[model samples]
Target: MSTQARPGWMEKPRPVTQVGKAIALVVVVALVCVPFLTILSTSLASQGEVVENGGWVLWPTEPTLDAYRDILNGGIVTHALGVSIGVTAVGTTLSLLCTVFLAYALARPNVYGSKPVLLLVLFTFLFPPGMIPSFLVVKELGLLDSYASLVLPVLVNVFNLVVLRGFFQGIPEELYEAARLDGAGDLRILWTIVLPLSKAALAVVGLFYAVAYWNSWFYASLYMESDHWPLQQVLRTYVVAGEGLTDTTTGEGTVSAPQTVQMAVLVIATVPILIVYPFLQKYFTKGVLTGAIKS
Candidate 1:
């Protein structure tokens, strides 16, 4: 076929179409970046600058780290930060381990009860237990008012489990047979063959668990005492509830304007995820697409 005789859809984009795409890309970037910039600028802005700008400083005339200093100076925010870190670290590790183990088991061929267990897992995903039922279960387990409550209730996410299971099942059965002939058991096969091949899925699932643990607040409010609240819940109190930081909340903090304090807290909460995302960005598309659709 002649090049000029090709269908219109096969041709390069027209100039107008290219221009429209470029404009759309810029608009999307602005929509994502502008809010973050505003937040960072407002957080760094001087009290006078923030006040003059009517609670928003898109470009601080004189940037200062006073808000961060106040938050980190032996404050409630600092403690909450510690709690969030500990919870996220411990929760992600445990959740990932449990998910990986369960997924591998379910993915194995002709495993006893694997089909029923998988069906049960999917059923839970489709019809999750309600808040009240979950609360009662937690209470029965005597996990309320404990950090374990946060981790135990959501240790294995169904979507992550399903993704991992799908990925594991996609591994070559020839590899399994070879491992077995070499005297490798399930654990050995999982460690030496399956895991090394499945790093992409693991990375994505780990990020999901980490983010979930880090950002969770509703469960904290339900199960934990105020003194044990995580950073997200504490930030909710300061920003959504419009509360001032007390002496106990932030030792030596002389309540800056709500905007500055809230923005600073937001930055602290967000920076960790931003820092970690780049490390795993390369794995996201591979993991999600392959895991979700490979089978």
Candidate 2:
């Protein structure tokens, strides 16, 4: 076919427009990457190097793991890391289980009060419970200064529940019928059939739960004592609140630059999400689109 006779859809974008898009993309990438680079570089930079560079280093002349080593060695950050890992692990598990069960129940066609229950859940999204009220409830429940305080209050995110429910509802009804004909119970069907097929949705939802638990700081600050604070809360204390590491350190050897330690904490707080995201990213779009579209 002649080039002129090709369909409009087949035609390439104008060269100038392509150039403009490339430039725009580069700008966006740089906007994101520059700060991250600076943080990483500054974290790796020695105290003297940071001082010489006037507080921020875009590139370290000689990178060192001293900051990381110092932070991880029996300090406030170390304890906070342990707390964050524990909370994220336990919270994500409980949240995923509760969300999945609730979503599955709601997704069923003839479940008693399903509509009312779903509506009630959705209503919370529209008018979320006030923080004070939530706190009071937690306190009344005797969760204050308890790790359970962080997880229990925010156990099932309405949006994640909706996504999971939609995905469950999208499963073909014939499968349920077939399982029932084979004398399979609801739990069996879920374990042997629904869960296996819904891996994408599960992965995506699980990632969401994990990220929420990982990034959570405010709840820990409110509900837990200082000793039980998570990594993000400790990050907030030292990095965001401009609290120096003097009090945080275990009175070890010479402390690194405050900026380096701060950036190291920032990097540590950020790294888990970055490490996790790529693995689940491939499923995120597919799962969300499939659930949303099919349901």
Tens digit per residue, CA lDDT, model 1, 1-295: 2346668778765888878888999999999999999999999998778888798989998889998987788778898999999999999999999999999999997678888998898899779889899999999999999999999999999889988999998899999999899999999999989999999999999999999999999999999998898999988987877776674534444454367878999999999999999999999998898767843
Worst 10 residues of 1 by lDDT: 248-257
Task: Report clash pairs, candidate 2.
Answer: none
What does the lDDT come to for candidate 2? 0.88
Over 4 Å off in model 1, which ranges? Answer: 1-12, 248-257
Please report how far candidate 1 places residue 276 from its true position, in Å: 1.0
Candidate 2 lDDT over 161-280, as tens digits, reads 888888888889999999999999988998999999899999999998999999999999898988889999988877777765654454643344378888999999999988988899
Pairs that clash in candidate 1: 76-249
TM-score of each: 0.92, 0.92
Task: Give Cα-based local distance difference scores for all models.
Answer: 0.89, 0.88
